[model samples]
Each structure stands twice: as C-alpha cells, then as structure tokens.
Target: MPTEYSLPDTLDRIYTNQLALEAAIMELTLLIEQQGHTEVGENVRGALYAIGENAGHIKQGIAKLVLQHRGD
Candidate 1:
C-alpha cells in the first residue's frame, strides 16, 4: 500500500519551519548588531538573510497550495 499524506500536517510543518527560520534570522541580526561590521559577520548576515527570504517564499507557496487544494 502507498503511504498516505495529510495536507494539513504538511502545511503545519512548513509553517513551523518558517517560524523557526524567522527566529534564527532575528537572532542573527542581533548578533551582527552587537559584533559590528566585520567581514565574516557581514558575510554570515547576508547568507542568513537569503535563507530567510527563501523561507518566506516557501511559506507563501505552501499557503497557495493549501488554498488551491481546499478549493477543489
């Protein structure tokens, strides 16, 4: 038998991951502020920002998928 998947459960997992990513971004920002503009800090900050942006996009896509699935 094929494994069953639940849309709502998957959505919840995505949402939780998004929240954790946002929190990590916030913490990283604070650390950067405290550490000042060192080369390594700037590089790390940029990478974290990119990750946060991707996570946001992922969350939005998941939301759209949920909406479309429900409309069916």
Candidate 2:
C-alpha cells in the first residue's frame, strides 16, 4: 500500500524524468542536424534514435497522467 503523497510523488518524478529525456532528445536532434549526417552510424545514431523514441513515449505517458490527475 502507498501513502497519499506516494502516487503524486511518483507521477511527479515521472514528469521530471520525461522533461529531462525530452531535453536530451532535443539536444541529440540538434547535434544530428548540425552534423548534417544521414545516420548516426552503426551504433551511435541508432542509440540516439531509440532514446528519442522512448523519451517521446515517456513524455506522452506523463502528459496523460497530468490530464488524468490535474484535469489538463
């Protein structure tokens, strides 16, 4: 069982993490664009793309949580 503060606290943490992840994705996008490369190579670009996708999902999930909890 969780306390009253626990659910919101956990959601808050998730939101915070999503914000950071989105920022990281934006940074990667900038880097890739600045480099003007078609790909990130065999490992690096692949990892970045995967991270960006996951971050997007996290952001979406957090947004849903906010809507459910805060009526946004």
Candidate 3:
C-alpha cells in the first residue's frame, strides 16, 4: 500500500516557520541593541527572551533528526 503524503508537507511547513521565527528574532535583536534602554526596552527584551526559548526547541528538533539519521 502507498504511504500517506501529508507528513512531508507538514514537516516542510514547520521548518519554514522555524526559519522565519529565527529571522524575526535576529531582526528584533538588532533593533533592541540599537535602541538601548528606553521605553521600548522592556518589550524588546521580552522578544529576545522568546527567541531564545524558540531556538532551544529548534535545536532539540535538529538533534533528534541527526540522531535518527545516524541510526543512534
């Protein structure tokens, strides 16, 4: 029997989202660094934090892929 095809599309969507989030986080970091401590400083700091948390998740996903491919 043929396997379902939905999973690859879903994986691609997720990977794209992760890339977009990473790019947005990079931009936000730049903006915050340029603005320094000001009225928007707190908000920017929160964004930076959220980015770090998201990055941790991305790293885990990548690690799992590596392990799976390596047959570990």
Candidate 4:
C-alpha cells in the first residue's frame, strides 16, 4: 500500500533531502578544487550556497508550522 504523510512530515523529508544534497555538493566542490578547477569549484560553491539558503528557508517554514499548530 501507498504511504501517507502530513504537512510537517513532508517538510521534514524535504529538509532532510536538502541537507543531503548540500553535503554531496560540498564533497563535489572539494573534489573539483583538488583537481585545480578553480572556476568550476566556484560555480559549484555558488550552487551549494543557494541550496543552503533554500534549506534554511525550509527549516524556518517548518518552525512556523510547528508554532502555528502548537495546540494540535
């Protein structure tokens, strides 16, 4: 059977995935730097920053939801 998830659950999953992606991006960035690809490393780091920003947004949203639904 298919599984079901609530809003918070979904958001948590998204946040987790974002973190994983961020880690992977960092690792890839390091590898690029090790290869002396400064330009490519910079580009990858830029993307990593964006992903981190989005993850922060997701975390904030999750906190807001928790506060909004505190009584529940």
Candidate 5:
C-alpha cells in the first residue's frame, strides 16, 4: 500500500481533534454546572485537568517531531 500521510501529519491531526473535543467537553461542563450539577461538573473538571496536562505534553511532542522531520 502507498503511504498516505506522514507520522507528523497524522499526529498533528490527532492533536487538533483532541483540542476540539476538549473545548466541546468544557462547554458541556459549564452548561452542566449551570443546571445545578456542581458535583458532576467538578468531576469533569478534574478529568479536564488531566486532559489539559496531557495536551501540553502531546503538543510539545508533536512540535519536536515536526522539527525533527524538517531537519531530515
């Protein structure tokens, strides 16, 4: 099979999707809190915290991969 997308390109797309999902989930959490679901919102917030941290790491890793590819 012919190669379609490179590793860096695929990882970047994944990162983009991750960010979009994170934003959508955050919006939902806000709406949930507004509906008096503080406990649920809090739980979601905790999960979001972990997601946010991993996102930063993923972003950095992708950047490094792109930079390395450019040096090739």
Candidate 6:
C-alpha cells in the first residue's frame, strides 16, 4: 500500500533535485570563472564545498532509509 508519497520516495526525490541543482550551479560557476570573475567564482566554490561535504552524508542516509524499509 505504499504510494509515491512515502518517506523513502519523498527523500529520494528531494535528493535527486539536490543533485540536479548542484550540477546546474557548478555549470554556472564554471561560466562565471570563464568570464574573468574569479573572485565571485571562488566564493561560490567555497559554498559549494560545504554543500558537497553534506551531500555524501545525505546520500548515505537516504540509502539506509531505503534499505531499512525494504523489510517492511
């Protein structure tokens, strides 16, 4: 009876969106750097570093959530 609105599904969707946005931001940051705005790009990259750090933990947590629900 589990629908798409279930906990694991919701989290997975959110994670997917997170990854997509990260990619988009990276592309934009690269473009900014190419345009000679190195300082702006560096600041954006600094924030991206933090986001990348947490992304690993978020992915692992989502995997654990899905695994735990497999037995349900």
How well is each residue in 1-72 modelled by candidate 4, as lDDT tens digits? 122376766778878887887898889889989999999999988888888777767788898886765546
User: In model 4, where do residues sit more than 4 Å from their true spots?
Assistant: 1-4, 70-72
Evaluate all candidate structures by whole-model CA lDDT and list the values in order: 0.70, 0.64, 0.63, 0.80, 0.89, 0.90
lDDT of 1 by residue, 1-72 (tens): 221255755776867886787688767767877877566667767787787777767777877876776776
C-alpha lDDT (0 to 100) for residue 56 of candidate 3: 68
Q: Which stretches of candidate 2 lie over 4 Å from their true place?
A: 1-5, 38-72
Flag the better candidate by TM-score, 1 or 4.
Answer: 4
**TM-score ranking from best candidate downward:** 5, 6, 4, 1, 2, 3
RMSD of 1: 4.2
**On residues 1-72, what C-alpha lDDT tens digit does candidate 5 reach at each position?**
222386888899988998899899999999999999999999999998999989989989989998997787
Model 3 poorest 10 in a row by lDDT: 1-10
Say which prediction, candidate 2 or candidate 3, comes out ahead on lDDT: 2
lDDT for model 5 comes to: 0.89
The digit string of per-residue lDDT tens for model 2 on 1-72 reads: 343355555866866775687577667766776787545533555665677677767767756765776642
Please count the clashing residue pairs in each candidate, in the order shown.
0, 0, 0, 0, 0, 0
Candidate 5 local Cα displacement, residue 4, angstroms: 7.2
Q: After superposition, how far is residue 68 of candidate 5 from its true place, in Å?
A: 1.9
Give stretches of model 6 more than 4 Å off.
none
User: lDDT value for candidate 2?
Assistant: 0.64
Model 3 misplacement above 4 A:
1-37
Query: Estimated TM-score per prediction?
Result: 0.54, 0.46, 0.44, 0.78, 0.87, 0.86
